[model samples]
Target: MSFQAYLDNIQAKTGKSPSDFKALAEKMGFTLNGKIKPDVKATQITDWLKAEFDLGHGHAMAVYALLKGKKPD
Candidate 1:
């Protein structure tokens, strides 16, 4: 699936947009000022996404990509 498709599916499943995830990530100290913290690991974010949103590994990675400022490609 395309990156946007993964994000769309996540939103459809979790009722959360990327912006919403960013806010929550900030709250979780995974991010600050709209950027991921340097000390944060991908697994930390992915694990949270998986456990909280019931997302699979690929889907959780999509969110991690978003956090890292990746664009759809």
Candidate 2:
């Protein structure tokens, strides 16, 4: 899946748009355009997804990939 595909998948699976998640992440200091730093980890993203949207590992991975400009293959 492409980055856009991942984002679309996330929305489809969780009923939440990527922009919605982006807002939530920003509130938590996970800026999408911020410098690449080690402060944020995949686990944090996973936890956030699970806690906020009831997303499982697969869905969370899709969200993470979209956030990081990656696309699942």
What lDDT is reached at residue 12 by model 1?
A: 99
Estimate TM-scores for all models: 0.94, 0.68
Q: Assess the local accuracy of residue 44 in candidate 1 as a C-alpha lDDT between 0 and 100.
A: 99
Worst 10 residues of 2 by lDDT: 29-38
Model 2 lDDT per residue over 6-72, tens place: 6677788777886677667777787646322368898888898888888878778877766676543
Q: Which ranges in model 2 have alpha carbons more than 4 Å from their true place?
A: 1-9, 32-37, 71-73
Listed per model in order, the count of residue pairs whose N, CA or C atoms clash below 3 Å is: 0, 0
Q: Report, for every candidate in turn, its global Cα lDDT versus the true structure.
A: 0.94, 0.72
User: Which lDDT tens digits does candidate 1 get at residues 1-73?
Assistant: 8999999999999999988998999999999998999999999999999999999999999999999998765
Worst 10 residues of 1 by lDDT: 64-73
Cand. 2 Cα-lDDT:
0.72
Q: Highest TM-score, which number?
A: 1
